[model samples]
Target: MSDKKNENGISRREFLTKGALGSFLVAMGGATVGGFALPKPTVSPGPSRRYKLGDPGKFPVGTAMKMDKENIFLFRDVEGFYAITAVCTHLGCIVVRVDDGFACPCHGSRFAPDGHVVEGPAPRGLLWLEVSRTPDGGVMVDADVEVDLGTKLVV
Candidate 1:
């Protein structure tokens, strides 16, 4: 309240104001340094989503093979070859092949052989991935690419 100066020749109000300003400047300096010291925002690359399943002839017709590492089911029907993701749409759990369809062990979600949702808890059907024949006569499946339910690669 008083404008009287202390022994240091600075008034109480001036001392407080200077102290507050110094603190604010120091805090801002530290924040700026911290921002610069932090690593730059970046996206690290991930593993490729494409997988090569050797010779289409190796897969017998009517064969439904599960690739555990890839989390996909490769099917070779009479029509052609198609791939379905084994990951459950409900909670990302791996689905197991059942007698009539695929069943999720974690949440009881079921999907038909064609990847259609047969039970609830899952908001959508399984993902049908893009399958294509490579230049070398090998079959490849792209898990990152989604295709229509009935889409198949007739090699």
Candidate 2:
């Protein structure tokens, strides 16, 4: 009866359009606030690790054992004990120790017993982590810290 619609007399199209506009505005406002309120993602080194691998004497000389769960190879040569990462340098694939050396099944990368890359596609040698004896007499491998080549933990 009048040019102005009565209260509660909104057409379905008008109602939907207004609702959509309101939703869009609310979403944009929330996004703008969130852009400033949300914390920015940070690039940082991972936390330090000190993994205990039990008594050092458990590993014997001339024995090479793979701790698959820890992604490390505990080796005891006639000289001493050492640790080499089982992770392939090429694509982070876990390497398996063969008679000759370590091999990556994922991308055909090969590493020597000393963790040196003997084949292509690997950028560098496998990581040699820092190994030390804890006060509790357990052996600890610091995966977060890599030591120089030929570094050994002689028990």
Q: Which of the numbered candidates is closest to the native, going by highest lDDT? A: 1
Q: Give the clashing residue pairs of candidate 1, or none.
A: none
User: What is the C-alpha local distance difference test score of candidate 1?
Assistant: 0.91
**Deviation in Å, model 1, residue 59 alpha carbon:** 0.7
Best prediction by TM-score: 1
lDDT of each: 0.91, 0.84
User: Tens-digit lDDT track for model 1 on 1-155?
Assistant: 46799888999889889999999999999999889877764665789999998898899899888998999999999899999999999999999999889999998999887878998799999999999988898999999999988998897
Q: What is the lDDT of residue 82 in candidate 2?
A: 80
Tell how far residue 152 is off in model 2, in angstroms. Answer: 0.5
The digit string of per-residue lDDT tens for model 2 on 35-152 reads: 9776665555565567887887787788788877788888788777788898888889999999888999999998887889899799999999888889998888887789887998
TM-score of each candidate structure, all chains considered together: 0.72, 0.68
Model 1 worst lDDT run, 10 consecutive residues? 36-45
